[model samples]
Target: MTRPDRICVGAIAGSFGVQGEVRLKSFCADPEAIADYGPLWTEDGTRSFTVKLTRASVSGGVGARLSGVATKEQADALKGVQLFADRDRLPSLPDDEFYHADLIGLTAQDTGGVTLGTVRAVHNHGAGDMLEILGPGTKSALLVPFTLAVVPTVDLAARRIVVDMPEGLE
Candidate 1:
């Protein structure tokens, strides 16, 4: 589907100020490139907006103006909205680098070939990336760092990942 070719480039945290600007949290490698990806689409692709970086917010995120958003209320309404860019417009990565979308749904296993679970999501809360694995018979998810020593092999062709979990981390 067309969705597969779109990558989540950033997200709207909420309105920036009394004006129509928005608080944007960019997930791009360059951060500023979020505004250069042309028109970004909402998760469902039902809505689209062109982004213009206004200024940097106090939280280290950038304030942006979205096309057609002309009031604080309009910007506030877009809180938590994910902004996606066309994959083709974005720069290609090196062999080792991967977009989060490509890693999602990949099967994860332990060093002893124990099935960990499927990768439900990849999160980066200012620290390094973490893989949220949803294992069988588990109400809660497991969080594993996405470091090379922990996750040794990532075979996208095989749709599988091999992780060397540390002690007490099953």
Candidate 2:
């Protein structure tokens, strides 16, 4: 099967009051900049949405109205829908920075050239991005910190990552 069509940029977290506005949880580094990407598509490519940021709240995320949504009920109905932008429209990263998508399939290896696994996913839990590596023939995935000490080299062109795993971490 073809790979999932979209990378999640945001999520609809229910409606924002009685208006058409919906609570948007953006996964972008700068949450408000999600609107700059223009129309976003669904995972299945069935629906497209244009986001208009209205306000931000303390507990909830930014308030936004989708293009075709007209009421709070409509907004509420779309809760949990993941939004995505075209990969090409995303801004280029600096030398030391890398987009999560670019690292997904790259091979993971130790500094000594021993194979570890392939990157199964990239996740950031408040502190920093962690590489979830799924080793060959192994069902369990290992979460490795994506810091300089652990991941010394990231050769995007070569599609490989040379890691100096933490002491006693195999």
Candidate 3:
């Protein structure tokens, strides 16, 4: 069963019409599938909403109506509010792929097996995924490219990652 500790899948982009519809931006692989994961929850899980897609959005998202939002004012209030779904509700990944949640918190080790740091977060800025490693006493986290050449192994069972640091990375 998917835990109630939801993983973010989408967000509200502001109201779409006078009839209480809002612009929804989905982060799912299939953008339209965002409505299938309902009822979506707030980050803290204190609130939830049933998402019903009405049509395509004009502002780069989809038009949708959220439960309890019956007026434009009501829908507009949800702008920027993120939507989350139970983790297990998400599709299973292939063996070579991984969810960002699964990669966080793993210990990072260098080629010589030296303990480097813990994985803090993963970021993707249109280029590729990058791992944020926070080593002890470091003022800033080390950003490592999550490439096959650099990250040769990710042992989820062992909660560790084997990294072959490129020159100047150390």
Candidate 4:
């Protein structure tokens, strides 16, 4: 996928200290891998930034200094700026491994080929990842575990996900 289709890997949460380090929140499974991708760009494909991890912070995110940001004010101005990397630079996934971007637009279908919804987001809270699938008529989003029992097949090429929805989920 091109940069436009690239997945969001991290975000600038503003400066950590008064010196120059900026607070960065990584969306990657391996948080430190955010720096491995180098030269992250903005959603508009206009601004690009290079991150240098300075230190680990007590808070969940890391402390980093952007290439062009030398002052605290400069870092503060970039608060809430999301960063994206070229999809090609990212490592290929194993049989079960998946990129969040690949699952975002996939159509969720039941075993009988009934359409459940499209995957709107993927989230994990120390536990396994959850597929946030949005049902066709339902206003509330459904959270399905990203496991073989729940999500049996994830065919990215076909742009669809075969999910074995639990008892009442269907």
Candidate 5:
């Protein structure tokens, strides 16, 4: 379950060194800004941490120390822990851009106005964003490239998206 008040900003990639520093994989547009959104909370909201960035890690992530985590073992145990920040603390995006969270659960439709599916997830595997949609009567999910030509319309207020399905994809 996702909280509307919070947004996931980063994840712990395990201990960076023998010290208390942990390798952090930031999902922010400005990766270094992850530390600015301090007091990040765990998924279940049971735990929270103040981030202090130390340096950049070799794994393309930043090395950071979490509040109350003061040992190699302590940092190691927090591997894969996702960190979320209060939505209010984040900067607002321009009209053309959207947060991944906002895109999830939106209804997807074809250019002809036929119902396709609901967006189950938004993925970016180094290239660009893709929308994962699961429709009725289909056993598999549909992966649509989130480009302006493919997805011409996104009506967040209506909770729907207009997609121009590619010929080979259909």
Candidate 6:
């Protein structure tokens, strides 16, 4: 389960160099801003680190130095570790925008008010974002494009979304 108080911002790709620098893959809209948020914490909230960006990494991520990580082995050991920041430290979105975490667990309904499923996850693969919905008896998940026309309503307060499922998607 994800913590409501924190939001994932980035992950450690691996060690960047022999000097203990790490390759950081940022999930933020403004990648460099990932380090602007105060101290970043591990998913479990056990480890915290202050980030100092060194340069753009060859792996398409940023080269950074994390607090307490001073050895190549130490940086390598943290590979794939997801980093999160306190939600309050992040900027608020516009009315039409949302954090991916906010969409998970929201009930999904059809345009006619029929219950479709629950949002299990949101994915973005170069093109755009897609919502993954899993219904009561479905083995395979329903993949719905998360465009303004398709996902017409996202009522966070009501914890639900209204979708206009495209033809043949049912």
lDDT (C-alpha, whole model) for all candidates: 0.90, 0.85, 0.88, 0.85, 0.92, 0.93
Model 1, range 1-170, lDDT digits (tens) per residue? 33998999989988978889998888887778899997999999999999989886537678899999999999999999999999999998998889999999999999888898999999988799999999988899999999999999999999999999977885
Worst 10 residues of 1 by lDDT: 54-63
> Model 4 over residues 1-170: C-alpha lDDT tens digits?
33545778988887887887888999877888889997898878888888888887538898887888888898899899889988887788898998887888899998999998899999989898999989888999989889999889988889999988789865
Residue ranges of candidate 2 with Cα displaced over 4 Å: 1-7
Give the per-residue lDDT digits (tens) of candidate 2, residues 69-167: 999889989998888888777787788888777788999999899999999899897899999999999999989999988998999889999989898
Q: Give me the candidate number with maximum TM-score.
A: 6
Q: State the number of backbone clashes in model 4.
A: 0
Q: Best by lDDT, which number?
A: 6
Residue 113 miss distance in model 3 (angstroms): 2.0
TM-scores for all predictions: 0.90, 0.90, 0.88, 0.90, 0.96, 0.97
lDDT of 6 at 49: 98
| Model 3 per-residue lDDT tens digits across residues 1-170 | 22435677889999987999989998887788999999998877788899889996457889998999999999888899988888777888887778777898899999899989999999988799999999988889999999989999999999999999999987
| Alpha-carbon runs more than 4 Å astray in model 6 | none
**What is candidate 5's CA lDDT for residue 169?**
90
- By lDDT, the better pick of 5 and 6 is 6
RMSD of each: 1.9, 2.1, 2.5, 2.1, 1.1, 1.0
lDDT of 5: 0.92
